[model samples]
Target: MTHQTADATDHPTVAALVARSNRLGGDPRNTNYAGGNTSAKGTAPDPVTGQDIELLWVKGSGGDLGTLQPKGLAVLRLDRMRALADVYPGLDREDEMVAAFDYCLHGKGGAAPSIDTAMHGLVDAPHVDHLHPDSGIALATAADGEALTREIFGDQVVWVPWRRPGFQLGLDIAAIKAKNPQAIGCILGGHGITAWGDTSEECEERSLDIIRRAEDFIVSRAASRDAHPFGPQRPGYEPLPDDERRARAAALAPVIRGLASFDAPQVGHFTDSSVVLDFLARERLLPLAELGTSCPDHFLRTKVKPLVVDVPTSATVEETVTALRAAHAAYRADYAAYYERGAAAARARGEEPPAMRGADPTIVLVPGVGMFSYGRNKQTARVAGEFYVNAINVMRGAETISTYAPIAEDEKFRIEYWALEEAKLQRMPAPKPLAMRVALVTGAASGIGKAIATRLAAEGACVVVADLDLAKATAAAAELGSADVAIGIAMDVSSEAAVQAGLREAVLAFGGVDLVVNNAGLSLSRSLFETTEADWDLQHNVMAKGSFLVSREAARVLVDQGLGGDIVYISSKNSVFAGPNNIAYSATKADQAHQVRLLAAELGEHGIRVNGVNPDGVVRGSGIFASGWGANRAAVYGVPEEKLGEFYAQRTLLKREVLPENVAAAVFALCSSDFSHTTGLHVPVDAGVAAAFLR
Candidate 1:
């Protein structure tokens, strides 16, 4: 059969390829995020030669197909890529082939070529797609996968037995296609599915057809078997009520995350989604989870396997925490052993093993609550959870038809420590200083609090924008980034219940808090004679009492995590400097200033640092000012409301207004490693207030 190929002006060819990739990637049933590649073989004109040259445009390395753009496509000269076969070495040296892809670039390639480049270029088709759809992997990992492939699709789709992905595997698939001219795709044993077609439309349709058929086949097979593929729910492992389960998860997240961060600090994601809950409650949960995931994409993010917490749904949070601590220790030991075994095997085979990445499991499974996945950042943690869910689906489908069999342990190790993968990791950008740290900033909806949150997020910290106004806080969080980077929660810091609930939400959102900024407060300026009981109480309750409550609750979690943290109180210059008609506010500010020193002394044993930032009268963009404090302060100072900032600036030694960002910068500096050894310190952002300066 002759295939019509697109020529130089066929830009639509690549566009259609991208569109098809996005469609397939958009659905979880088709492929997990960043787990697949799509390519179109077309022709583009060589600028110098003015001749149409055959080229291959494939999804590049480390990119998600769902969000693929033209620039994310790696362009390669088809002829040069095909020529790689001439000097190709054996499987032992297959990794070298990746380097050769650079030499096959068509001009400056738009993006780096991925490991699967050969699989697409070598295949004799204009369009090809390699996907990790759950249903397809289910068929791939089944014990009788090859026979099932024949039985299900006859000759339309063939089975290619397991071979670690590389140049050889690509050659193997190409050979199979040559032999089976009628074949449109193949199920890669212990891996995934790859489909090819004469046209882009045909390729996408064929890929979807394979996935649909595989899913239907699993459903049909399951109809004759027990409804629960993973076995009936274990007697004591049923899911708790939604509220209780979440509360338990929130309580447990910090402990699990801290343990997971034994080697390096990690951000975490929690899920009580139906699939995760169902899997956790099953009788076969332990055995299947122990067997680990089959697909390389699944294990790379989730680690070889997850650490499962053995506890009943009715177990108390304290009891579960005890169990988790013990489980984590054992998991670390087992992981070390696994690494040694793999390293020994590599040495025997005359290949030096790569250094161990980390002993901590990236994923943790609790019988009653849910799964907690951890990584260097929130997105990685979330993706790891998603990949594990895909693995669970694969296991369920595989069990429906036949015994589920993942690749051998040694094989998993080989891929896990693959030199190419290590190189890819090395190429990643250095992490930001605050990466993996979670911060909860009260009053973060606006003003100095929002500025601090923004700065922390910019430095790579996961931020929880906590405020009494949930909507404004949420909006602020959204402006900062996605849920992985920031989340907003309603937090009335003055209320103990609200503070506890808000911190719980923060823990659930990003494992635990490493930084807490007590920036929530209201200001009241009144003469001693005119200050009412209500004014005094409101000021004290919101600032002095609020800071204490937030600090106390956050300290409990910080100590429980056993991870050192920082708590910075946003005080005021009036804390030290005597100011007229500011009795109530100044007293509360003094209370906050003292709390910092007191907590710093108490929490030092736990490595928790407490500090404070004092700013002079901030008028512009100040929430307190906007709410009427500016006019009150201006009147007391005998200056116009608009001149309040300038008035304060002129009085300062630096003669510069202290904006919200200036206060934010001081907060950041205090929480940063720069101030690691200097706690109980008050940094004034009030230009140069000699009276307020620390003596």
Candidate 2:
């Protein structure tokens, strides 16, 4: 793998490596999460000696190579790292290896080097890139992988059997490369493939070339014996129609979501993309999908084998969910046995037995329906979903060429429970209280509703921005974050049909609703003597009636799903203390405050917590003010309209203007586990107004 050229400049070399690494990183079929790493060797002046020393700039730990930056590549003295081969022979623990890697650091580069730094250092080429391409992994993990490698690549590639990644593994790779000096790169069985050359472009070309060969091999074989598109089917079996299959999937979605979540605040979302449904439609789906990860790199995310739910032919949706529940139980029991088998094997080999991970399956495959990926958050779930697609492609390719044989179960367990890999999982950030929980925020386009939606999203909830103005709602959702994080829809809460339809859309998008903020309202400030019948109806229709409709519809979805949820109404300080020229606004708010109490009493038995946030003086960009309520209120107080915000800020005991964010904070507190056991509570966010405090 060694090459040196006088024409090579550091700028082009680094640029080429970064570009190639990003291309691979961006494609899930090539790599996932942070699974693969890339490196390029160049000469640098030693700071102290001022001597030219060769350094390996490799992808660092915990950063995705797809978005790799120059700083993300740790610089290590290649000569010093390669020398660790002698030291590795005597080391038995990972800590010692890590210490040796640290000692090899060439500069004050603060990036934590990947554990594979030593392995990359051993590659004989200046530009090296390792990838876990689905095709490469498919051929690498098969039972006859060595023979296939010899047949397909001939003497171009060196084949090394699986060795737990560490100092010893790096040493083994170095030894193989030394023996096969002219070989392009080596294929690490049950792992991944690597390619190296004088230029980053050459290395990338070589790696992709090998991947294409494997892909071609599979295509050729499948084409020659192309008898069944659905793979080998069971005797006398026929797959259900696509529409029927999808119908079953939709029916089972809520139940699958429930099973994926924990009793705590955690919730796991599910997705059944096209590839998943296509895979589920395959013949002999259970055995093929159960072959485990295509390579060891996938173990950290998808687990050893997906949970397969057997959907018997001619089964109804109810029967399907019942079967899924029972299958989940059996899956847990099987996982226990699998863990025990691996632990005993480790003990026999005189290695420290690793602790068992959670029994919940990250990937779920249901026959006659579709696959389900469960993760604490949507991104992780999508990763699982993406890798599962990779696995299917790998398996299908391998099955077409020969009998599909992934690494043994024991090998899968070793990687799944490896301490370093476990550390990666442990380093994931602690989840926010509302992580993955979906909330519907009415009037989220602006004002207090917008603040509440933003806060909820920051705490990890996916917010649906429901407002009367479709454009504003859409724009607000976009401003908050990605569509996955926040979506928007038009909902005139006063209309019963519109409220019901809006709630339905929310449920459709997020599986089911967990929280609702009835914050959409307007102020009609006409005095009782001058107020028309329309003024009273308009205010009541939006505030009081609107609150009832949204609550009833959202509560129906929550209760039907049997998942305890929260509902909050945006009442006002006027509800507790009426003000001059505010009859219509004050009376309607007061009515809803009482409604909150009544609904809380009724919904409590069903684990639905109903509460209210009463905020005053949120005058900046207030919809009420924009609708002409502020000028009238200022005139009543004999103050100019422009001074209203300041006047209200000075009136509070804290002398802090009550912003919508303040009200949002209170609403978040009520909706979170902090108030899990407390409901029917009206929290004020007016900065200590004596008149507005609840009795």
Candidate 3:
């Protein structure tokens, strides 16, 4: 897709539109992570006809307004779109309309236009901004939302009742505009706000000003009254003490995440941010919080209503999990019933309802703790969390001003199953293999561990970089990518206490572990006669003892979470193909080889698989080489240390250099379902080393 430069040198209209769109997109109060759309209409050179034609530059589907560039906006011939609207005048045939939208594209290398293009095109203005603003939706979805809008803005804005957004909504907008020519904007009931102006700045300023007015109305009323926002007003409940609330949230996150994973193997992410915590702390508002989302636009992200569970006041993990699982089952059953009811209502109205969506609750509300959001991946979870936060804010504001009310149940169903939203979802890429799973890699500061961690994160798994050096681990995690994808922690695997504490920290940070890579090791090339006791002790502690400690601790968590998991050890080829002067390293690796088999036998019943990878002559970026063991290894082979990598590569049957990435690939394969049926097996990533082949 072509990206428009944010340069001010473009046509004044495009430049102004880009500037204002970016400004609105940048602020969460206006737009969330790519949640809103912006557009501008102006005359542009028509390629087909040597004439200036009215064209609409609108935010493309999936484009983030905050970082929008010129290429991010699709340009369409307004005359063509307006005419197409007349062709399908009475009702919306969604697929046909979307295809027609694609056929009207006038810009080169632009992404797909947003489904809301019709509404923007129908609004006769130089600039239009449509956003799911919290304050705006608060006033739009209130019990007396129309009255509130009239009282707050009077004829300044028009109220458009809830309609599934499509060609029909565009027609309604046009009709509304024709009657209320002086209105600056229109509030879509249980949806969002759409504002227009003769110029880009005027439209943007008007939108912001309207939102500010709503904010003021809510705040002023809240300060005047002691009653809850939603009535039959209940007495205000004091918040839980900070320490107890934090402790409760921490203890309950894993259980909630685990329960959310009911049928899935991967536990989802959690959002215990201060906003969520404060909302949860208000014990009296728990009932209202379970009502539903603030606006219908949030339906796709958070479902109809969050599944509410009892506050884990002083509960144990086992107790919480049991309660949560029961609550989750009940929630799913209720969701199924709710859908059936909506479907029956649609049929009773003589309208065929769309297909049913998944019954799982995306947002889970725990009264005493905090809210938790679930998604197939981290980004989805974050986006859902953001929408829920906005919902909470809007609900609070509306309640403080007047009784809070979302759209009716039937409208929720229509919005949640809107064909336009479904089409957008259909365009998304299929999820990767490691999506949503969490992996922990010890000694991830560099080499094989680093490669494994990076690969896992790239494949969509959240990674934990555990290393003895916190600084190096932190830097390494940063390099892997976003903080949501990976985190770095300090841990010396050889220390039992450190390993235990590190696992606890990891569990709290990422919900629970689904995969563990036991890769920490120390190398020494001392012959049996020359091997020192210290060398033997150190090698065994890190390689054998360390892997065991990590494996045992990780197993405990996986068992507790009750989700099947994978554990892979990065043992050495030396364990299978012993060479001269490698006594300490070889023996410890052999110990790990046997350890993997024994642990696999023990963990199989718990649904935890154990495996190992034996990598030979990964000398190029070997931590062993960095520690000066390459010279000692080269001395044994009668070659220069610098040539050892080449020597090993040439000696292998494949004559290929076995890099750290190759070993990481093997670890990933063993961890994934590719080798799911087999455990206690050690795969060799040594470019086909004949001597290292297991018998």
Q: Each model's C-alpha lDDT?
A: 0.92, 0.78, 0.80
Tens digits of per-residue lDDT for model 1, 1-695: 22323322248888898899889999989999999899999876786666778999999999999998888899999999999999999888999999999999887788999999999999999999999999999999999999999999999999999999899998999999999999999999999999999999999999999999999999999888856899999998999998889888888888898899999899999988999999999999999999999999999999989999989988899999999999999999999999999999999989987899999989999987999999889999999999999999999999998889999999999999998999999999999989999999999999999999999999999999999999999999999989998999999988999999998999998888999999999887789999999999998999999999999999999998888999999999989999889899999999999999999999999999999999987777789999989999899889999999999999999999999999988988888888889899898999998888877
User: lDDT order of candidates, best first?
Assistant: 1, 3, 2
RMSD of each: 2.7, 4.2, 3.3
Error of 2 at 349 (Å): 3.2
Better of 1 and 3 by TM-score: 1
Cα-based lDDT at residue 8, candidate 2 = 30
Runs off by more than 4 Å, candidate 3: 1-12, 92-96, 107-109, 228-251, 263-267, 346-356
Q: Find the 10 residues in a row with the least total lDDT in model 2.
A: 1-10
Q: Choose 1 or 2, whichever is better by lDDT.
A: 1
Number of clashes recorded per candidate: 0, 2, 7
Please provide, for model 2 over 614-687, each residue's C-alpha lDDT reduced to its tens digit, 9 standing for 90 to 100.
88868886877877888888888889998988888788898888888889999899999989998898988787
**Of the candidates shown, which would achieve the greatest lDDT relative to the real structure?**
1
- Output the TM-score of candidate 2: 0.89
Q: How would you encode candidate 3's per-residue C-alpha lDDT over 228-324 as one tens digit per residue?
A: 5543322232234666655555566656666777756444556667666556655445576667875655767888788876634455556766778
